[model samples]
Target: MEKWKKDYLKGILRDYPKMEDYYLERKEKLLFHTKGTHPHSTTETQNKKMLISISLDRQLINLERNQKVIAQCLENATAETKEIIERLYLSDKQKASLDLVADQVFLSKRQVMRLRDHFFEELAEHLGI
Candidate 1:
């Protein structure tokens, strides 16, 4: 593999867990988005807490931006490639094992592994790596 491809895959793998967490957080927010306290809590202590929370939210916003770029790349891939990538790397609840995905796609485990390799190659190509 070339240097650029190595770097591309490295960055993606590094951020993969955080990306999954981002998806899970979105799901949780949908369930509890309206349950948070009002914006006008007047206790000085509470106000200080909100300011700290705002910085944390800013970090999440940046993660969302990075995820959007990745999501777009995945979106443009072929359906088979997209499914393989998602199942192999991006599932929030559980990482799909090679055997499981192979069963779903009716291929052998070796074939599924090859497809994953190909998926990363295609992703790097898409990113001009």
Candidate 2:
């Protein structure tokens, strides 16, 4: 993969967990706000709920769509490739660097870099990008 493509893929992986966290946080906020007692009138509360619901729904849809796309790409990949991608990105709160991934996978850092590049290449192809 080209350097830019590799960087792009890494950026997406880095952002994926953050986006998931944001979605969950917003969902919790929406539920909490809608259910909790407040000083607002019924009409005001209902309006607020409706707006929150719409915003949450849109965020949920986007998160789900992106997850599905990532899932599909992983599904099409070899087991090792999939594992490398997920371990480096989706399976943890903190993103793993290629060196850390190499250690985990028992490969040299350079080998891990190659795998990452190939993984992105395959993922981009699967995404038709």
Candidate 3:
């Protein structure tokens, strides 16, 4: 193996328990059965990244359809998700991550995660995702 691979492997070996559990949790219902086709099978590595990509894609579709719900979701908070959404929508930034959005909105990481989850849940239900 290459030097970087060894270093990465060592770390993964050390953190395998945590990493495996996390990967498995995020791996559930990963591929969209919405199409009813097999689609393409992604490797383990791609599967996780694809999951994140799918999540972000869904969020974008939600924003395009229901801008009001997003505003309502963030209207009462410390203005974190709202600011994030504004930055994304007003410009062509697509989506600002919770970390980047949190930093810009001056909200803690935990706060950003909570708000994003709540907002996304509402969007999911509204969009019938």
Identify the leading candidate in terms of TM-score: 2
* Clash pairs detected, candidate 1: none
Cα lDDT of model 1 by residue, 4-117, tens digit: 676667467547658768755754554343235654555675556655554456546556655766677677777876677777666664667889988887789897777677
Candidate 1 residue 13 C-alpha distance from true site, Å? 5.2
Q: Candidate 2: list runs displaced more than 4 Å.
A: 18-63, 91-95
Worst 10 residues of 2 by lDDT: 32-41
Candidate with best lDDT: 2
Clashing pairs in 3: none
Per-model TM against the reference? 0.47, 0.56, 0.36
> What TM-score number comes out for model 2?
0.56
The runs of at least 3 residues in candidate 3 whose Cα sits more than 4 Å from the true structure, single-residue gaps closed, are 1-78, 88-90
Question: Candidates' lDDT values, in order?
Answer: 0.66, 0.72, 0.50
Mind sharing the TM-score for model 3? 0.36
